[model samples]
Target: MLMTLLMIIFAVMVTALALTLVLLISGVHTFSTSFSPLSVSLASTLFGLGVGLLMFGGALLLFLISFEICKLIVKLITPSIR
Candidate 1:
C-alpha cells in the first residue's frame, strides 16, 4: 500500500514537471521572436531555467534508479525478516 501511494505521488510529480518544462520551452520560443530587449532577456532567462530544470530532473531520476537498484541488491543479499 505504501509503495503504491508513493508511486502515485511520483507519477504526479513527474507529470507536473513535464508540463512545466513544455510550458517553459514554449515561452522561450515565443519570447525569442520579439524585438523588445525585455522580451529577449526574459527568453534567455527562461531558457537557462528550463535547462537547469532538465538537468535537475535527470539527476533526480538517476539517483532514484540507483537507489532502487541498491535496495534490490540489499534485498537479495539479506534474508526476509518475516
Candidate 2:
C-alpha cells in the first residue's frame, strides 16, 4: 500500500515536471519574440529557466529516492527461502 502511494506520487511529480518543461519552452519562445532590453530580458529569462529546472530536478530526485527506499523496504519485508 505504501509503495502504491509512492508510485502515485511519482507519477504526479513526473506530470508536473513535464508541464514545467513545456512552460519553460514557451517562455523561451516568448522572450525571443519580444522587443525588450537585452539585459533585463536576459536576466528574467535566466531566472525563469533556473527556477523551472530546479523544481523539475528536485521532483525527479525525490521520486528516485522514494522508489529506491520503497524497493528496499519490500526486499526486507518479503521472506526468502533458500
Candidate 3:
C-alpha cells in the first residue's frame, strides 16, 4: 500500500517535471525572440519555476530511495515469526 502511494506520487512528480521543462523551453524561445521587459520577466519566472521543480523532484526521489532502503534493511533484520 505504501509502495503504491509512492508510485502515484512519483508519477505526479514526473508529469509536473515534464510540464515545467516545457515551460522552460518556451521561456527560452520567447527570450530569444525579443528583449522586451515583459518577455524577460516572464522568461526568468519560468526558469526559476522550472529549476525549483527540478530540485524538488530530486529531493523527493532521494527520499523515496532512502525509504525503500530502510524498509529493505528492516525486513532483513526482523525475525520472521509468522
Candidate 4:
C-alpha cells in the first residue's frame, strides 16, 4: 500500500538523515569539503546563532548556545498552514 511505500522511502533515506544529525550534533562544518554552500552553512549557523530578536526592536548577544539555536531553527523550519 501507499503507507508501506512511504515507509520504504523513509528507510532508504536514513543514511542521509544520519549525516544531517552528525552535522547538527557535532557542529562539524567543513567549509572546504564537498559542500561549500551558504544554504548548508545557514542551516547549521542559524542553530549556532543564539540571541533571539524580541517582539520589540532590540538586540542581545549570546556567546555559545548551540542547543538553543538548534531548537529555534527547528521551529522555523517546521511547516505550518499556508
Candidate 5:
C-alpha cells in the first residue's frame, strides 16, 4: 500500500514537471516574469510547478537512497541470524 501510494505520487510529480517544462520551453512565460500580466501568470505557474517538483524529486531521491542503505544493512545482518 505504501509503495503504491509512493508510485502514484511519483507519477503525478513527474507529470506536473513535464508539463511545466514543456510550456516553459515553448516560451509560455510564467508569473514571475517582468512582463505582461497574462504571460507572467502563465510563466509563474510553470516556474512554480517546476521548482516544487524539483524539491519533491530531492525527497524521492532521499527515500530511495535510504531504502537501499537499509536493505544493505539488513542483508549484512541476516547472515548471523541463521
Candidate 6:
C-alpha cells in the first residue's frame, strides 16, 4: 500500500540522514581545534531530532483524535440520514 511505502521511505531517509551526520562528525579532526565540531554537531542533531519527533508525535495524535471524532459524528448522523 501507499502508506506502507511512504513509511518505509521515511524510515530509510531518516536513517540515512542520521548516519551521514554521525559519519561527518566522526570524520572531523579533534586534535587541531580547541572546540570540537563533533560534540556540537552531536548535541545539535540530538536536540533537533528530538524536537522533530515530538512534533511528529503531536501531529499524529491530533490527526487520530480528529479522525475518531469524525467517525463518531458519521455514526451518529447515519441513522438520521437514512
Model 2 steric clash pairs: none
Best by lDDT: 2
TM-score of every prediction relative to native: 0.45, 0.49, 0.45, 0.24, 0.46, 0.47
lDDT digits (tens) for residues 27-80 of candidate 1? 555544343466558666676566656655665675566556556655754564
> Model 5, stretches more than 4 Å misplaced?
1-39
Q: Candidate 1 has which clashing residue pairs, if any? A: none
What's the number of clashes in each of the models? 0, 0, 0, 0, 8, 0
Candidate 4 lowest-lDDT run of ten: 51-60
TM-score of 5: 0.46
lDDT of 1 at 27: 53
lDDT of 4 by residue, 6-44 (tens): 455455456445554554434433322224455466666
Instruction: State the lDDT of candidate 5 residue by residue for 1-82, as single tens digits.
Output: 5466456556655665565456444343322343545545766666766765565555556556655655665576567568
lDDT scores in order: 0.58, 0.60, 0.58, 0.40, 0.55, 0.52
Residue pairs with backbone atoms closer than 3 Å in model 3 (clashes):
none
Q: Write the per-residue lDDT of candidate 3 for residues 3-33, one digit (tens) a residue.
A: 6655765675566557656655655555454
- Every model's Cα RMSD, please? 7.2, 5.8, 7.8, 15.5, 9.3, 11.9
lDDT digits (tens) for residues 1-82 of candidate 6: 5456446555655655565455444333222232436546766656655555554555455555555655565576567657
Candidate 3 weakest ten by summed lDDT: 73-82
Cα lDDT for residue 18, model 1?
70
